[model samples]
Target: MRLGPVLHREGAFGGAGKRLGLGWDVAGTVDATGVATAWGVGDEVVALDHGMVKPLGTHAEYVVVDAGAVAVAPRATAAAHAAHAATLPLNGLTAAQALDLLDLAPGASLLVTGAAGAVGGYAVQLAAHRGLAVTALARAGDAELVRSLGARHLVTDLAEVPGGAVSGGGVDAVLDAAVLGEPALAWVRDGGAYAGVVPQSGPDPVRGIRVAAVEVAADGARLAELVRLVDEGVLTLRVAETYALDDAAKAHARLAAGGVRGRLVLVPGAGS
Candidate 1:
């Protein structure tokens, strides 16, 4: 909510994978791994920061992940779905950390800006599961979507949210997932906790309320939990469109257009 993307260059579990400006979330079968590990030659796995031998990504056919960072893929979710789930870890972890900072109990008040976004959607469901009064602030089209994720209150615009209606003089916690600067800051009620993914735009949390920029980490355990939700049919993966790996330029263009809703998956096996 307060910041924009935070870029980092950190190595994953294996000494094999190094940060080379690669994508984080990844899914694939281990082509091969080292000795004394549960993952074998053909075991399918998901890993956070699992880069293929150093600069490669999930967009490729093969990737190498450290044994510790991976877990078995859910049988019910498709490969594409599992691949998409790989992307959810960072955003999901942001939601988890933000909640920890808020320190609110069940039935507390929570608001997520950019509720229709990748991470916002996760935050909404997580807050709802915690039994909070979830409110989603997003474009008018997203109201129904957010509501389905357990947001009881949907505000198409900030001016529309009830003033001082949430606990502690406003929503108990604010997760800013949209435009980082003023839009997100203005939405958080005074005295309520605020968290942001973009450190560039929002006020850092100082007062009793905590404010933070979001940077998601890879956690196979957490990813598995999200996987469980999808398997139970409680969570759904929405892909607006997919592009072949070679058509990556067009995919970038499409994402730039902002016309695409849901995730844009890149199918490596698409027609070459």
Candidate 2:
């Protein structure tokens, strides 16, 4: 189980007395298989349950996921494991799909807000790997972190972005991972693109800029590629903390308190 921003929001303000399950990412060994499925019992796997409202979530010890949504887990390395792999499905896919939406070519200038956050960090790494000129907007303290993630430029303040980075005097596109909305949109050149993480809630298009929010979908093939990247060291994973699955409430509280640098994972049968 993994803690995500959406899970925090849902537990905090998703209304009371509802029995909705609250998780999207899961990594574990397959305990069973259905007829005609390619997966077998005992396959180490990772999957995204992919829904805002569901009767059951991936937070549990056992979860039911579509065969198409599951991928072979990353081979454990000295620095990573199922906990790290758990952080990949939702956040990694969101970044990859958002980049797909932006559709920028190599050498195009791009800005990513919240560059230190989970999705934003992945966006920085993936965008740089694709050869985009990435300017990351994150806290002053995170300059080194974002830089290590492959950001070509780092800005503590949005106003620090240089106008000459692009031919149009603004970034060719903006991946608004911080959800700065209109403020972030202002940094995009006319006729450029903007991609937000929230589905259908992005700012309206202006200055001929194309604006769209990513609604991350489950893609096992794409997820497998990401897992391979992790193994190849093309991608990095960080786990901020771990908790026993029963301590979910405490985990949620920590998430609400903010300042988490990496993902908080819930380990089944873990101690305190």
Estimate candidate 1's alpha-carbon lDDT, on a 0 to 1 scale: 0.64
Residue pairs with colliding backbones in model 2 are none
Error of 2 at 160 (Å): 0.7
lDDT of 2 by residue, 1-272 (tens): 12346554465425456677877889988899999899999888898898765677777888899999999988862223678878899999999999999999999999999899888999999999999999999988999999999999998887888673343578999998878888888888889999998877789888889999998999999999998988888788878888889998898888878778878888887878
The residue ranges of model 2 lying beyond 4 angstroms of the native Cα positions read 1-18, 77-80, 164-167
Candidate 1's residue-wise lDDT over 113-213, tens digit each? Answer: 88887777878887888788988987888778888988999988776765544333566678776745444555556666777764333575533555666
The lDDT of model 2 is 0.85
The 10-residue segment with the lowest total lDDT in model 2: 1-10
Candidate lDDT values, in order: 0.64, 0.85
Instruction: Quote the RMSD, in angstroms, for model 1.
Output: 4.9
